[model samples]
Target: MEEDTDFRIRFSSLCFVTDHVGFCGTIKSSPSDFVVIEIDEQGQLVNTAPSKLISKILPEPNNFAKKTKLDLQNLSFEEGSNQEVSIFAGCSGADQYHQSGSEREDTISDGTSKGEEQTVDDLGTLLDEKTNELLNHFACDIKEKWNSKTELIGSSPEFSLGRILDKNQRAILHSAIRQKFPFLITVGKNSEIVVKPNLEYKELCHLVSEEEAFEFFKYLDAKKENSKFTFKPDTNKDHRKAVHHFVNKKFGNLVETKSFPELNYSAGNPNVAITVRFREKTHKHRKRSLFEYQDRKVIYTDDSLRLGQLKGNHFDIVIRNLKNQINDSANLKDRILEAIENVKNKGFVNYYGPQRFGMGRKVHTDQIGLALLKSEMVEAVKLFLTPEDLDDPVNRAKKYFLQTEDAKGTLSLMPEFKVRERALLESLHRFGMTEEGCIQAWFSFPHSMRIFYVHAYSSKIWNEAVSYRLGTYGSRVVEGDLVCLGEDVDDEHFPNNKVHLVTEEEESANTYAIHQVVLPVLGYNIQYPKNKVGQWYQEILSRDGLQTCRFKVPTLKLNVPGCYRQILKCPHNVSYQLKEEHDTDVKMEGSHIDEATLSLLISFDLDASCYATVCLREIMKHDF
Candidate 1:
C-alpha cells in the first residue's frame, strides 16, 4: 500500500534503484491496493488474508459505577454508538476512584465506599490545578538533570516540597508523589518534606560524541599534566566500551593509563573507570589505523541468511489500485510493461519498506520496541496507545485510559480488529493496576510482535547503513567489507554465519560477488563490517541511547539476538499486463474492487523478508 514517505524516513536513507525517470502513479485508491499473495518455502502460492474469523465479546467489569456498552464499528462517545461510558472508573483501591476532569476528586476512605472531598496539603499535591501544573514542570526538569548527572547517583540534588504540617496527610502526599515522580526519593522530618532524584532506580548516561567529550574534559579544566580525566563508569559494558572506543579513537595515543579498582566495586560488576592522564613529553605516539581500534572479538553475521540467490516462479500482482477510469491517464498502460522489464532486470534497493515501521502510525512500532528493550514499560505502553490521527476516536479512548485508568472502557472504544490493543487491555483488567500488571500487559503480545519492534528499530539503522554504503562506495565492493562463506550459492547445509572480511586476499583475486556483502541489525550477537560502517554502527547505537549488548530484562525475559540481512534483493521473472475491463465483475470476498482501466497487473516473486511495495516503488518512482 502507498504511505507517507516523510514520516518514515527519519534517517534519510532513501535512495533509488535505477536512474529511470519513470512515470508517476497513485496507489490505495481502494482497498484492493493491499492485496498480497505470499509464496511459502514450499513454493505454494498462499493468499495473505486473516482466515480466522474473530467475534470476541467481553463482559462488563465492576470498576465502573456507571453502565457501559461495546461498539464494534462506531466507538464514539455520542449517543448513537453501540456503547457509552457514563462515568470514569477508578484503580484497584477500594474507595479511591478517579473523576474525569481537570481536577480529579479523590474520595476519603472511611473503611467503605462513601465519598468525601479532600483539601490540598502543603506538600507537592497534584489535587489542585496550579500545583499539578507546577509539579509537571519541575518533574520534567529534575528528570533531565537526573539523567544527565547519572554519575552522582547516591548524592543527587534535592528539591524542597514545602512543609507537610499535617501528619495524617503525609501518607497521602507520599502516594501522590509516587504516582507523578516514580524515580524520586522523599523524606519528611519535623513536618518539612523534601524530594531527591532516585538515581538508584534508573541508569542513564547521556550519550556523547568525540567533540562533546573534548568539550566535557575541557569544561572540567583537566588540561594540566597528570590530571585524571575520567569517563563516567557504567555497569552497562557495551556503553562503557562505546565510550572507551570513541575516547581511544581520539585520545588513546595521547593518554597513558594507570589502572585502579573499578568505581562502585561492591556492585559486583567488572567495570573500570577510564582514569588516565597525558603521556610524558619523551614518549612517542603509537602508530595505528582506525581498523586496528575495533574490539578484538570476531563477531559474525546471523547464520539464517545465505550468500546466494532465490530461485522461484513468479506470478501477477496489482501495480496500482486506482478507482476512476484510468486508461486515459498519461499513456501509463503502454509504458508499464517496459518499466516492469527494467525493475526485473536491475532490481530495486532492498529497503525494509515503510510497512515495517508501522506506516501511517503516529508513533512507529520500532519506537515502542526500543522502549521495551530499554525496560521502559510505561513508555512502551504510551507509545502503543498513540493514534495516527489525533482527532480520531482512538485518541479519545487513549486519553480516557490515561486519565482514569479504565481498562474496560478503553477496550470498548477500541476497534474489534485491534487484537493487540485488546490483548493489552484484557491483561491490564485481569492483572489490576499494579507494577506487575503493567509488565504483564506488555507480555500479552505475541513473541513475533515483540521481535518485530526490535527488528523495526534495527531496520531503521540498517537502512541508514545500506544508504551510506551505496552512497559512499557505490556498486564496487571495497576492502574491509564482509562476504559469507558457503559451499554453493544455493547450498542450505552450509554454515552461513562464517564470513570473510574483504582484504588483499579476496580483493586482489576478485573472489566474492556484490550480493554476498551483508549488514547487521545492531545487537549483541551480530557483527559489524570491518571498516568505517562498522565503526558507524557503534556511534549510531550510542546516539540512540544504547550499546551493542543484550537487552536481558529478567522480568520480561526478552532477548533480541540480532541477525544479518543482505543489502540488496532481486525479483524473479517480473512481468506485467494491462488490467482487464471485466475484472470488476469478479468480486473479492467481503469487499468490492473498483474498476480502473490504466492499471498494470505486474507479477513478481521475492524471497522472504522482501517487500513488494519497494519493488513497485522502484517502477513507479512515486511514494506508492
Candidate 2:
C-alpha cells in the first residue's frame, strides 16, 4: 500500500481530511485525477483512500444515485474547476439550529481555520445530513402514496396527494393524483358542490353552470328517440353507453357513466318571466236637438222628430208637419216650445235621457216609453216619405231609410215585452208609485224618471216594505214586579187600561211612563234600564221633575211571530226622546237590553225634552 499526505475537502460549512502519510512522487494536475478504493489494498495506483467520501453519499428516495464520492473527486484539473457540485448528505439534528441572519447564506465550508472551525464544520455536515433525511422522508412518502400499482383507499382524505406534492415536483407521472373539483360553480353569489366523475362533462360545465347538465339530459332523451325514459340499475350500463356515444358524437368528447344519474335528475331548466302593461281611454257624453218651436223662436223635437240622431233638415220638416196639423195656433206654439226645451235641456229626447243611455247612472226611463217613442217616429217617417218623395235628394237615400227604420223597429218591437213590462213595473214600484201603464205615462218625463230610478233602486225602502213595521207605543208602569203585556198585545183590542200604571200607584210601585219610548228596526238593539225597574222608572221619569207626558198606545205593533215582552226600561230620561218603536227594538237587540234589561246602570247627560227628541230621531231612522 502507498501512503499519502493529507488530502482535504469542504462542503456546507463543514471540513475534513485524511491522516497525514509520506509519499515519494509529486502529484500532477490532470483531468483524470481520482481516488480509487478497493478491497485489495494493492489493486489501484492511487496512494490513499477516504471513508469521508462514502459518508457524503446522498440517500435517494425515488431512485438510486449512480455517481459516488470517488467519481466526484477524480474530475480533471480543468473539469474540476468547472464542475457542478451537489451535496447529498442526510439531514442531521444540528440542522434545526436557526441561521444567524434573516437572509440566506451560501453553504460553502471554510477549511483554513483549525480547531474552532472544525466544530462548526462538523455541525455543517450534521445539518446537511438532517436536511437530506427530511427531504428524503417527504419524497419517499409521496412516491408511496401516489403508487398507481396498488388500489387506493378512495374515501381517505389523503387520497388528495397533490396537496402534499411539492410545487417543483412533476405530477403528470402519477395517475393516482386526485382531481380537483370546485366547491361552487355559480355566476352569482350562489355556490354548489360539483362531484361529477366524468372529466368531459365536468370540463363542459362550470362548477356553477347548470346548462351543460340540462343539455346532457336532453341528449339522453334524444338518443332514446324522444321516448319517455325510465332508468333502472340493469339499464344503467346501456344508458351509459348511449350517453357516451351521443356526447362523443356531438361534443367531441366521451362522458363518464357516473355523471349520468345526477345530470338526468337535476332541475329541468331556468325560464324568464316577462310582464306587459296597457292604458285605457275615457268616454264623454253626447247631445242632440229636438225641434224648433213658437214660429222658430224655440225648437221642438218632442212631437215629430226628436233631436236623437235625426238630420237637422229632417227635424225642421217634422216641426212644420206638427205645426201644420195644429193650424199654427198659439196653443200649438206654446206646446212646441215646451216640448223643445224638455227634449234638449231637460233630457227628454225620444223619451230617453242622455244620462240614461250610457254607463253612468242610467236616467231611469221605462223601456216602454222608449218603445212608444220609437213607434211614433217610425209612423211619422213612413207618413212623410212616400216612394216619390224618397226620389228627392233628402229622401232619396234608401240606405238611410233602411238603417233608421231598422233601428226604430229594434227599439220598439225586438225587446221582449215581458222584460220591458217588468222593468217599468219595477221602476214604478221602486218610487212607491203605481205600476199602472197610465200612471207610468204621466211620469214618463226625464225629470220624473230621474226621481223614479233613484227611489226604485234604494235598498232600504224595499227591504222595509216587505218586513215588520214598528208603530207608536203607550206609557205604562210595572205592577207586582211585572207589568205583563199579553202576547195578544198585538191584537188591537188588547186591554192596556187594566194594566196598572206604576206612576198612578206610587206606593210600593215603580212609577214609570213612556219617559221616551224608543223604536228600533231589524237587526238592531236599543239600550234599556236594568232589572231594578223602580230605579229605571224614577230616574228616567221623575228625575226630570215631572211625573208624566202624553201617554198614548201606538197605532201599530210587532208583526213578527213570538211572545214579545218588555225586555228593558231606561230611567235616564236624559238620553230618552221620542223615537220609533222599531229603532228601540233594534237598539235593545244590539245591546242585549230589552224592557227587562238588567245589565246596565249608566245614564246619559240629557233632559227629558232633548232625550225624547234624540230618541225620536233614532226611532225614525230605525223602526219606522
* Model 1 steric clash pairs: 316-603
For model 1 the TM-score comes to 0.51
lDDT of every model, 2 decimals? 0.53, 0.23
RMSD of 2: 53.6
- Please, what is the TM-score per model? 0.51, 0.12
Q: Candidate 1: list runs displaced more than 4 Å.
A: 1-13, 28-35, 40-50, 54-315, 320-338, 390-392, 404-417, 429-435, 487-496, 578-597
Best by TM-score: 1
Rate residue 471 of model 2 by lDDT.
11
The 10 consecutive residues of candidate 2 with the worst lDDT sum are: 185-194
True-vs-predicted CA distance for residue 623, candidate 1, Å = 2.1
In angstroms, the error of model 2 at 202 is: 60
Query: Which runs in model 2 stand beyond 4 Å of their true positions?
Result: 1-501, 511-624
